[model samples]
Target: MFSLKAALAVPFAKFIVKKEQKWINNPLETQERVFQDLINDAASTAFGVDHEFASIKSHADYVKRVPIRDYEDLKPYVDRVVAGESDVLWKGKPLYFAKTSGTTSGAKYIPLTKESMPTHVAAARNAILSYIHETGNAKFVSGKMIFLQGSPVLTEQNGIQLGRLSGIVAHFVPKYLQKNRMPSWETNCIDDWETKVEAVVKETLPEDMTVISGIPSWVQMYFEKIQEKTGKKVGDVFKNFNLFIFGGVNYEPYRAKFESLIGRKVDSIELYPASEGFFAYQDKQNEKGMLLLLNGGIFYEFVPADEFFNENPIRLTLKDVKVGVNYVMIISTNAGLWAYNVGDTIMFTSIKPFRVIVSGRIKHFISAFGEHVIGKEVEQALKEGIEGSNFQISEFTVSPQINPESGLPFHEWFIEFENNVENVSDLATKIDAALQEQNSYYFDLIKGKVLQPLKISEVKKNGFQTYMKSVGKLGGQNKIPRLSNDRVIADKIYDLNLIK
Candidate 1:
């Protein structure tokens, strides 16, 4: 949408360019003005739906009155807009739908639009530029980079299908950059996500590739298959490739495993892409990235994560954010998401142009048992415990499940113990202790902690990941989201001894 429709947006984009000039030079300080402008814009074109924002006459009033919204709340608005109603929530013909495995629900089909296309594009370019600015490296501008993205060849001309976004990009990418794109058409379908990936293997393995990008899990899978096929590993194939860029999810759990498998040093790039919009990215020098919103395309709002959002929630400006506190990223985008919560919680690491770290998903918390434990809280506790106790943990999965017999829900942590000569219980106690000290909520509400005395399961040699992978999911993006806060997947996961 960004590159292909460059012509249509030139004039409108010029206006956007003019508006964003002030913030363009690091605009985190102008949050209040941006947030108001965004709300006003949404009110003016409330999708032709009988929606809340449609009747708003003043942007200020709308901004003052409207409550923050989540995906589920917005889903109804999306349904109306897609069904051909004009509402402030949606506008124009949907360019297409971006398919996502919804955090709460299993799948989410979000509508993309022409108006919002630039937001995605600009956010993307900004990420690249921001990375270059951070690292003082302009090598990307000269080299051939591979985006191991989904197949872009569309089954229909209308970009309304699940694969339409990827498909359209392939068909419309500036012809010059198209050749460098990775992943053949076969690997980009909903019919079988892996089948399409397999196709990318056949086409890319024999080639001399310099730079590669993709969801790390799939990329790693391809490398493993390549090694199995030719008796040579990732080091053999990617020795010459200088950089690896990936972002749909976290790679921290697999960072060491990947480095070991590749047997070479590769620059790793992390991206935080949203079908709603491409929000931020990681740069080389700063492990944390400066988030340059499609500042020109959409307006942003920040709500403190600790406060009750449904009640009298405090929405702050970019200037009000502290360096380490979590805030729910709300944006009123060109795509008709007004005061829409993107389900991500990021903390500002640096205020210069607002560099932040994606701490975790707001919904990625596990409190199925009434003990509220968030991903960030758990990660922090674990990191603290590791440092304090000097216990090494390779990877772990925290799932909340209801024991059929106990009639009470509990948090089960499938922990992967590192090579240590001593006791597993000691480490478990240390972790629990850390949590009590770090986050009191979890400690008070937690009923009983069950630590698997055995660190290794015979079915998988290395970690708890083998069981998750065996269940047909990518290690990076499709992690078993912690906050089922329900017993659904948790029970199923518990029933099957992942390793055995």
Candidate 2:
């Protein structure tokens, strides 16, 4: 029955794939259309009127009128919308507010308009459809699929519903897949992540689960729970499980551990979803980067990452983006975000079809000693260091140890190893060398005797998990930072005695 359903869906999936290729081929034209639509639609809104969106003719005019803003900068307008003001940001009050915990700002409420909400659902659906079109594997669609996400329960502020982005997405799951979705609503609503995972393991253990999706770290906890309960590999328990859908963090670091936990490899899809917008997803299995959603209801601007902090940085449209250059992505969306800085930095791996890899966050970097180390550099370095080696890392984070109470200041890497290494110092040396090779400033700092080699502080078993739980960010789209500019996280980990 399931196989027949999958067979019937193939043609429809292919048709959608063919339609998507149109915008993919003409990226610039599609973006221009989206830009014009956003401007015309929101011209009467408070933000648009204030920025003279009616007079904006080109990208140049738009740039000249609207300055790039982060969430805090746009909060005043958002506050009006929250206070039930119509036509403040968008044409009308938002349908929902994606409530997320912000670093500087206590909590951020990103608007989800009627026009914008469907785009999120469509992007995710299209990702799966594209995968099926490419691989001819829609069998997973018929089988039970588990999405480890936040509670669907939402609170009302004024007249709009508010919830986590993932939670809001839950309410939008297609009707066809509702029957095949795992973990009961009661189980999902359980707020405690550990308790929820335990419930999910019990519910899914007896089911024929074919697809599992979540952030890798949280999913790792789920996988471990399954292993503990069954005393068998995840693959042995769920033989049909073949599709792993993930986002929030890079999967390369956890690939080895995941494979070990499953006792085999599985096809995976990487999605680039956020509260701001659903930007991109892996279109092809062998692709290096995600296919950027050019036709999505969002207009994009890219500023060179190096010059992003400048008084007046050059903001280039998709047409001007170059391969291999790090760029800070800015967006103007149908949801009424105008010239908003999403805080993520990306690099174009392919420009012909416009594919991008999320390089790092604009703020999540270690420049404590002027080395300017970014997330991509650290992840790549760790990946290189562990390749072909027996060292399997569960989780890790890096921070600058400036006043180390020892010799010269250095990078402190707190890593939770999946398996014990023969010599941790050897692993640390390899990682440090890789980091030095990737970051020239760090190399010069070390060579000039201003900074010492990076050190590894072994995190006790499940230390990262304990640290996350302690801070009330255990799961549900929460992720550990790969790099921190300061010792805030590092100090917290030490205070908890998570370091071995």
Candidate 3:
């Protein structure tokens, strides 16, 4: 079922990749120079805001200008840009505004300008370069590089859409380059995997796929499927791959499953990206730590965790950031977001030239499977489910996972629903179903056989709070995986069933 046209693209793609890498990795500090120039431009705009008429520029003055702005303060500015005004923020028309599911609040709109395209490409494509470095192979078999991210078209009326940054670029790249992209601009990913995309993943010989990019979890799921279909372990598929790259977060939760598939450690490129913008990515194949910030297109201002999100924040230069402490990353990019708070947290790995590890989100996530599921969704659903039922409880935690037997991924709600809610299991299922009936992607996942239904784990009274208390973050971060669609974990949750 593989397209002959797609097959023919492989050789040309391989050649183009080499040329692209050359353009992407000019001189070592070349990006930094581009970054400095971009910063000077943003600062010039920020500084000129003074004289009701207009003003002048100072390299030091830009740095010393007003403190970095956060999400709340920049809302009005973003609104102005959306309305297409000649506001102080964006100088030109919106090329495209990449969106994020704004992990903390609603949705985020990160604008892109013609000026910033190369930086995005460099940050994203380096994963390919890093793969060649780590795996020591770049030769290919066949098939186009498949990317799993958000649809190029926006769906939700108002919400920060979560997706890989590469998804947006697939549509905008020139038609000559279009042959390298997957079919259709209307395709859905993440919440709803495209059938053709899934089929390509299923049908292609692992050896044939030289490069693969997707969320870590979905790739793991695909790896498992490839094994089931071919009766061959992951090593068979990986041996053929010149590179394996994943975006989203740390691959630790998936480490065991992925390793099991490959039967050995397959080198991978871990990318750091946001739906709002393609941020930083690994610069070297051997580098297994924090990504080098794409400082070329974005002016960065780090706010110390202790003081960063405060009423007033003190900014840190690329040179001033300290190691071993958490900091909120703020970026003023060519994408028209100035001092925009993306709401993710990080700790420095090295302080000299600047390297940091992704700690976790500033928002709430149990992070059990590292799924990045919002705790509020589960909590809100359970609250709504127990509406009339007399389920009494001080607190609760809901973990979602795949039901291996049914072959459908569903939520196995681990709940501490308040007292006297008879039939918590049945009520939990009802609430889960209701949520999906309202939320289309979850519904599509069910219809398309991507996810199973929902089940409940009835916790014995004090268990929920006790679990949270044991983790040192009683009132804070530590909870459990709100979303896990993995078989290994889901099976355990199902077998335990909270009754045991």
Candidate 4:
């Protein structure tokens, strides 16, 4: 029965792929249409009236009316929506609020309107369908699929349901996939991440698990637990488990560790999803970047990352964006996020069909001594430095060590290694060289003796996990920032004595 159903989905998947090619081929047109639709739909809402959306005709006109806003800047309007005010941001009350923890603000409620909610589900399904179309492998669809996400339990706020984005998405799993989904509802409701993983392990032990999906860090924990329970690799236990779907964090740094955990290389799909909107997904098996979703009810604006903080930075449309430049992604979505900065920095790998890789967050960087180093640069440096070596990194983070007790100040890297490196000092030197090669500012800083070379602090086994647990953010969409301007996380790691 499962095989027959899987066979039936192939044709449907191919059809969807063919249909998506239209928008992919006409990116600018599709974005313009989405932008116009958003404006027209919410013309009667309070935000539209305040911004004079009814009079807005073009991207230029819209931009002139709506200034770019972060969460804090837009909170006033969002508060009205949360206070049971209809048509405050969108046309009506949001179907759900994706509750996310903010750095400065407590909890952020990102509204998911009726018109916007389906895009999240559709994009995820399309990512899978695109994979099937490209690889012609649908047999995995017949087996059990597990999404390691938050509990489906949601609380009500005003007239809207509120939960973590993953939890809210849990309630929208397609009926066809309901039976194939693993970790029964009761098991999924467990709040403790460790306990939930154990429950998931016991339930999925006897099943033919095929697709495993979650954030890479949390998924690594799951794989570790599975190995602990079975005394075998994940690939050995589940022969058919071939596809790994991951989002939230970059998977390149974790690739070597994951391959070791699974005991084999498996196909993986990288998704660019957030509480605001589903932005992109890996559409090709061998592609370097995910296909940016132009027709997915989002109007994108790009501001060059370097100029992002400047007074009135240039906001370029899709057609004006250039390849290889890191830009802060701004979006006006059907969900009523007007000129909103999603906070992600993306570098366009391709212009035709529009593909992008999330480079890093705009706010997450290390520039203490005027050597601005972004997340992508650091990840690339580590990957290049550790290339072909037996050293496997479990997790790592970088921070600026402004006031060193002994030597001139330098960048500090806290890394949890899965295996021991023969010489940590040599590895650190290689990584520093890689970073210097990529970033000229960093290179000049080192040459001018403004900053010393980067240093690595070995984190004991599961040290990052211990630090996260200490702060009450062990799992469930929580991830460690790759770079920090301050030593907040570094100090905490020291406090817990997780450093070697």
Candidate 5:
């Protein structure tokens, strides 16, 4: 019925793909132009003037002039902007504040201005458009594509609009495609996640759902609800469901469960986006990494993951980065963030094309007793350990138990499963053995008895979901931290006493 939509988009999508391919071939040149443009645009802002933007001639000068900052360092300026200050960070007041989950450093309000909206909104749109162009799969756009996003109902803080990042992006969906979007505004605005999912299920079930997009976890929930309501797998209900677009969390561990829920495998694409920016996306199939958005409105820097916590670490630009080294990402963007650490770590897989895989977050590493382990290691271990296991993990988090009262320093895994395990001890041992093989530091700790072997606690059904609800992080784009450095969140999970 809507073949015209496919025909019209094909030419434009091809143009974008061709342009991106050429830009990616010359990443350094593209990045330099982006950085220069950002500096020129924000030269009059408070931060720009304070850092003497006029004197910044190169990436080195910019780095030296503006010290790397995290959200805490920029909070004062952001607060002033929230209080109606103009030109504090950008040329004018922000159009909205993207409220991120407080899971790590507490809830943060990232400013979003008109100049920045195109980068965030258009990049996401291009992910799909690029997929259609590269794979010649535009028919999906002819049918409904449900994006499981946060409620667009925003709050006004000191005359500035604020809401979840996903919600803000949803408001900017192109008018041409509004007819194919699902979940009415009222249905999307439901405060409770459980209620919202049910409403979304009802609204989208009777429609032609060709593409489903969101975090894998929430999409899994929506699939389960659909199966429960109709006694049929998601694919059976939506025969045209062909593409799955996901981000916000690694999909490796959840792939098995997602396939099981859908009752078959579906082509999927991954995106790397945060409240701060849209960073990368899968440009081709059967690829292990995402192509970085080099020509986007952002400048990139990398600090060696091993040296990121050091007092002074060497910084590398796009020209000097090496594939396979885990690096903490820093960026300067059109949105007024300069040399800012968004807390994510990534490793490049293809230097020529600048493709990267998200490794983990800096704060989300376990190093309580010098057994420093990152999210990538833990996830890899779990995937290997569960390869042939009878049960599947729905969600999990690991933390250090350092107190002697807890019986020696050790790593504790609180896991929620899709099905109960036959032998908990065996599962725990397999996971520990797998982790030890991947991380020598952890192996040494266990060998030297500085830390005991890892321990596991099986969670009751819906335990993690209930905990997320209690903390008001129940819906779209929020995810369980795979690893924590301290016992803060782990203690709460232990207190839940959902052990099976």
Candidate 6:
């Protein structure tokens, strides 16, 4: 069959693959050029003037003059931008404001400029293109791809479009690929997730779906709907399905269940896109780490994760980082965010070619007893616990129980199972053991009696969904947090537990 979409995508995809390959070949040169270009592009902007960008010729000067900041610190400038102010953060007003959760901090409006939009588009396109070039898999582009995305309905805030990043990206789908997209405009516009997913199942059931992409949990929900509707696995419904591209949440804990839902092994790709920028994506099939974007309209910085709470912490640029150190990712982007902390933590797995694996979130951790357990460790522990178990987990979260009057302080895990565990306590023990192996501080806390053993609270079916719905965060791009330092989110989940 002649594939017009494939034909149209191939040339540009190939060009991007080649370009990225060349760019990664000389890391230092690419970093230098990207930094210089970013500085030059924003030299005339208000932030540029205030920061004295004209005199900054070296990385040292740039680092010295500009301070590392989080979204709260950048709020004044973003406030000015939101008030229809031009040239406050970027050269001009942003085309859109990516509305996303600030987690415990509240909501945020991240600017998306003309210069920054291409970074997301190109990086996303090249991720697929790079995979195709490596595996000679043109079938994904040859057929329709069911991108489970948010509705591209915009609400104007100061004459600026404000919506989810996925929605914003959906509107910019290439004309050539639009024919190969799914759910229809009307179906996608449905605001409710349940209604939208059901409609998607009906719309996509009869179509050719070779590739499916979304957050892992939402994709799982879609697969469940397909199985419920057709009484067949996803692989049977879409036999041509060969690619599963996922992001937003760590895929490790859900990997087994995702594989079972599809009913067969498929090629998978992971991305690390935030509202601020498209930072990294899996570029190699055999590799364990994602290739960090160097030339994509963004200049990178890293602060040691452990030292981030300090009044002034050691900030390292791309040229100064070493592999294996956990760092809170910071970026200065063309989108008008300068030295902004995006909140996620990552550690470089390889430095020669610059590959990273997301470690955890800065705020999402259990350190009440100074155990300092993070999302990555918790995720790994969960994966280890479920290795040979018959049960599959749907969703889970952990929080510290620090009240001394309530017997002893312990970490509580609220888990919703896809299948019932025959020995829930045994699994919990294994998970606790696995966590101890990963973090010595956690083990010491347990040994010193500073914290009690990990306790499991098996939640009822759809417990997390119910919780999310109750909180009005049930839909697009909203993820169940893996770890909470306090009992704020976990206590609500505990209240929703019917199984306990």
Ranking by lDDT: 4, 2, 6, 5, 1, 3
Worst 10 residues of 1 by lDDT: 451-460
List, residue by residue over 1-500, the lDDT tens digit for candidate 6. 54766665667667778777787988788878888988888888889999999999998899888998888899889989999999998898899999887754587899999899988998888889888777877867767787788888989988899998998998888887888888798998899999999999999999889999998888999999999988898998898999999898888878888888989989999999989999899999998889999888888889999999998888888889998888999899989898898889999989878999998999888898888899999999999988877879899999988884677799989898998577888988999999999999999988888887898888888888898898888768888889999888876875766545
Give me candidate 3's TM-score against the actual structure. 0.60
RMSD of each: 6.2, 0.9, 14.5, 0.9, 1.7, 1.7
Clashes of each: 14, 0, 11, 0, 0, 0
Instruction: Estimate candidate 3's alpha-carbon lDDT, on a 0 to 1 scale.
Output: 0.54
> Which digits, one per residue and each the tens of the lDDT, describe model 1 over residues 1-500?
12333333344444544554567565743554554555555654543233445555544555565667777877877766546655336545567666656657666767667776656665555555544444544444443466656546444223354443444455555554566555544455434455555666677777667677776655666666677777876767755665677776566655655665677776777777767777766644445654545354556666777774467777776657788887888877667776778888888877766677676777777655445566766666556555544444555656655554454445566655444425555655666777777666666654344322112222223333454556665432454453435555544544665443
Worst 10 residues of 5 by lDDT: 491-500
What TM-score fits each model?
0.78, 0.99, 0.60, 0.99, 0.96, 0.96
**lDDT by residue for model 4 (108-207), tens:** 9999999989999999999999999999999999999999999889999787999999999999999999999988999989999999999999999899
lDDT of 4 at 107: 90
lDDT value for model 2: 0.93
The alpha-carbon deviation from the true structure for residue 269 of candidate 2, after best TM-score superposition, in angstroms, is 0.3
Cα error of candidate 2 at position 297, Å:
0.6
Q: In terms of lDDT, which candidate is stronger, 3 or 4? A: 4
Ten-residue region with minimum lDDT total, candidate 2: 1-10
lDDT of 5 by residue, 224-253 (tens): 899999999999999989899999889988
lDDT value for candidate 4? 0.94
Deviation in Å, model 3, residue 392 alpha carbon: 33
